[model samples]
Target: MRDSSSSSSKPVLTIGLCFLVALLEGLDLQATGIAAPHMAKAFALTPAMLGWVFSAGLLGLLPGAFIGGWLADRLGRKNILIVAVLLFGGFSLGTALADSYATLLVARLMTGLGLGAALPILIALASEAAPEQLRSTAVSITYCGVPLGGAIASIIGMAPLGEDWRVVFYVGGIAPIVIALVLVVWLKESQAFRAQTGEKIAGQGMLAQLFGPGHASRTLLLWVACFFTLTVLYMLLNWLPSLLIGQGFSRPQAGMVQILFNLGGAAGSFLTGRMMDKGHARRAVFIAYIGMLAALAGLGLSTSFAFMLVAGFVAGYCAIGGQLVLYALAPTLYSTQVRATGVGASVAIGRLGSMAGPLAAGQILAAGTGVGGLLLAASPGLVVAAVAARALLARRNRQPQ
Candidate 1:
């Protein structure tokens, strides 16, 4: 009975810890956008420079995901996750203290490294902690913290902090360190990882692990799906408010939309995961991508505040929710041996898309592309993502499950 009780609590403890870290990550991820105007004013940054500022953290994520995953597979998930939390938390503080553009970029880049590293580990831990039948639900529950955290950041940004953008970073940074301590006391290493034999745990080289035997096709497909999906998601996350303001919406109205978007994302993340777990993987994919495309069109064409709010919520629902679906799918594709490595690589590739999205949006808008044109251009990518994700699910279904 004691063993049963402890076993039952493992998933709860694991998912709870992962969720806290994810929450802090979400806060930091959106912090820049919330504080962008103040950051721009304080440092006298141009639009181009602000784009780089957004990309800097994403740039860190690319390598961080790869290296963090590689190491997690060999070392252990909980240890690496704790280190990642500390790294990001410390750098978040650095972000608050940065006095120059160069310093700000460096701080954000370091913060990205920690954030990037923490994500794959979180996914792996949550997926491993839950029963196989409930894997998607577990991961989605952990992932919901991200959008919810972003909503919190939006609220902080709206507060009368007197435009002291540093406060946002300070909050984002300090909370993770506290969580890290809690994790140190409570988090457990993945039982699956512990159960693996030494030889299997030390599996083939990185290239072989990813491209080994039947993995190449799925790996490529997952990358394609993640890349395009994140491109749309991050573009909206970093640029949505500015886009709304460009279209004549007030700042407060834009902020409200942002909050609703994240709230919708939290709901979508949970629902989509539950849907996939209920043997509706294909249906979930269809709904997520189709909803994304339609939401984009709505955001582009809607003229009223009410309509735009609905559009933002739908966009968040589909885009951020779609991302959770991809994440949940990633772990099932690889064995416990290389799970983190494979997931990390997929995440790293997706980070490239994330980095590109914000920069591309900036350039496109600078080139006189209106909000509608910019949103419309994303349609093709979502279509590609939809096709790749569906194909991957079809392939998974063909396996001897």
Candidate 2:
């Protein structure tokens, strides 16, 4: 009794709600970075301490990705998604209330747990809600919200509305609470998720499917590619403004550059995601990796302010856009039976890279590895990701589709 023609149309409403959630995630993700200079002065934080705070937030993400997906499978996606939003909203409030370094750090960790859980679910929902032909485009449509949110954060951080860094956290916390209430009324469980019955059929376990015959190599290469690419992306995201500040720019000026970075991410997400819809996911990703490698090198080498902004934008386009491609590619690697696990595992592994990126960058900065030196060091990671993407393309071509 379903309208087949209706189903063929994209689920605009559903994707819009998911995009809203991602937009909030993007906002919260950059909140700490925007507030870093203020927080550093208030708490007397060294570069190493700031790095720990950044890494602490990401640390929760690794486990949350896996745990959230597992819970979504059993409790239903809507249920888990609602709770994740609530947790983030509540902790973002906590972040605003914190007066001490320790309190702020703890608040970030809690906020991140909610953030980590929400993203994979949103990505999965946006993707599965749409028809097959538009899959990657659907993913990108939802993912675009991230940079859009970051751009908003940049604007807010620089706006004369308030100099208090806590204002950003207040906005982050409150907006999601309102959004979660909206989701409670508006968001539905994914159709694909509902259609799946929790029957124990004869097959390998979820993790086994990832490494099983015909899948092990593809999964492994994707993991390596995801891990390295994320490392580079997070480094830029968590520290770009800080790096600019270190290079002697005012906070507002640095924030402007960061805004450019994310705007590029938004543009790239649309362009590359559309290309993937044409069955160019692998090629688009490989090219993005190469582009990011060049951009990272430029970021380190260029001293001109204009060139720095351009470099940040290009880097954001390539690396952040490339990450979204990985998100899109992950679920397709398995059948519906194994899709959640495959995507969850990939997210979990990628988040581990996220945690490591800020921490390592912190140590590097603390040790006097100048911004140029750090960026140069990071370029090789994109090379590895590019190679892995190319290998995955070849391997998939060889497989019997």
Candidate 3:
């Protein structure tokens, strides 16, 4: 095991690798959503069927997170992450040739297992290697990969083949294989993790430790936050393009709007990381959520393409921006012994929200509620999340500074 405590060569390389892994995590999330419309027509999918495609991957994620967390503690982060990348990358390539809706569904589920494992393990490794003064910033910077990946997926979805979303999937899937190969040659195990593993962590079970008394409250809150955030974020990400197309934008135009949304998210993520580094974690999250609420409301009322694009950017900014807080916050909430467990639990819970987002949006669209109506319906979740962030911040402030 290698400890990255000093300002040295391996720590820098490890952080860079963590950044790449983080990007892949977000890219996988955006793939299904950005390509949803094309996928729907290809399979002649009903709204419910499309919803299932989104949820299937999320379902796999729950178990993946749990198992990956436990494995990180037992076998170390490097090995588990390499396996996850290969698993997801291989499954994503398999999706390119999926002949039936059922086959596609299964591939997504398998991909979710791999994708789910990547985040926590990466976060755990980055935190271990980062210097204390820069830890939060590094964690948040690594998290920027999600929005950047999502943005890339949107850009790729706009390719000449138009609605043949399979191309995007193939590219995303293959990337992890490349990453895994590189990691095998370049990376090493974390020294802090290695030192602790032989002692208390040796016989610990993740499930038991995650639910243990001292950690119970923080664990519950982490899950609640993740669930709400994912539900809102994924619902919008998965359905927004189709919703725009329904409003009369062509598929290409709709994808373009999705690109703008990702662009805003990417910008927001970069700024959030910088601000969190400068000690504005709570303010940054609160303001971002406020912007999200406004963007959603504006989206419900606007019909102009320009307005929609602007609204999409703002909405994405707030929606995706909060991830910075989650990435930096989750690891710190628990001790090193359960760091992976905490991150895995938060992500697993969040997947529940992610699964619900597409389902609820699908039902609304199928029922003729329209995109604006659907967005308005979803706004309350953001409001509640804002309130929760405030409460959490106040509590943290009250704790001795």
231-338: candidate 2 lDDT, tens digit per residue: 988888889988988888777778888999999998888788899889887778766988898888878877788988898899889988899878877767776655
lDDT on C-alpha atoms for all candidate structures = 0.89, 0.84, 0.79
For model 2, what is the C-alpha lDDT against the true structure? 0.84
TM-score for predicted model 3 compared with the true structure: 0.93
**lDDT tens digits by residue: candidate 1, 1-401:** 99999999989999998998889989999988888877888899877788899899889989999889988888899899999999999999999999889999999999999999999999999999999999999999999999999999988877655558789899998999999999999999999888873855334465675776667888899999999998889888888877887899877888899999999999999999999999998888888999999999999999989998998899889998899889999999888888999999999999999999888888888788799999998899999999999988877777632
Clashing pairs in 1: none
Cα deviation in Å at residue 309, candidate 2?
1.9
Per-residue lDDT tens digits of candidate 3, residues 1-401? 24544437777888889889877777887788877877888889999888889888888888888788768877889999999999988998877778899999999999989988887898888888888777776776677777788888888877765556788888888898999999999887887788787665534455455666555555676676667777788888888877787888877787777888887887777787678778887889877888887888777777888888898888888888876667677777666777787788787878888888888888888898887789888878877766666565555555421
Clashes of 2: 0
Off by over 4 Å in 2: 1-10, 160-163, 200-204
Q: Give the TM-score of candidate 2.
A: 0.95
Model 3 poorest ten-residue lDDT run? 392-401
Q: How far is candidate 1 from the true structure (C-alpha RMSD, Å)?
A: 1.4
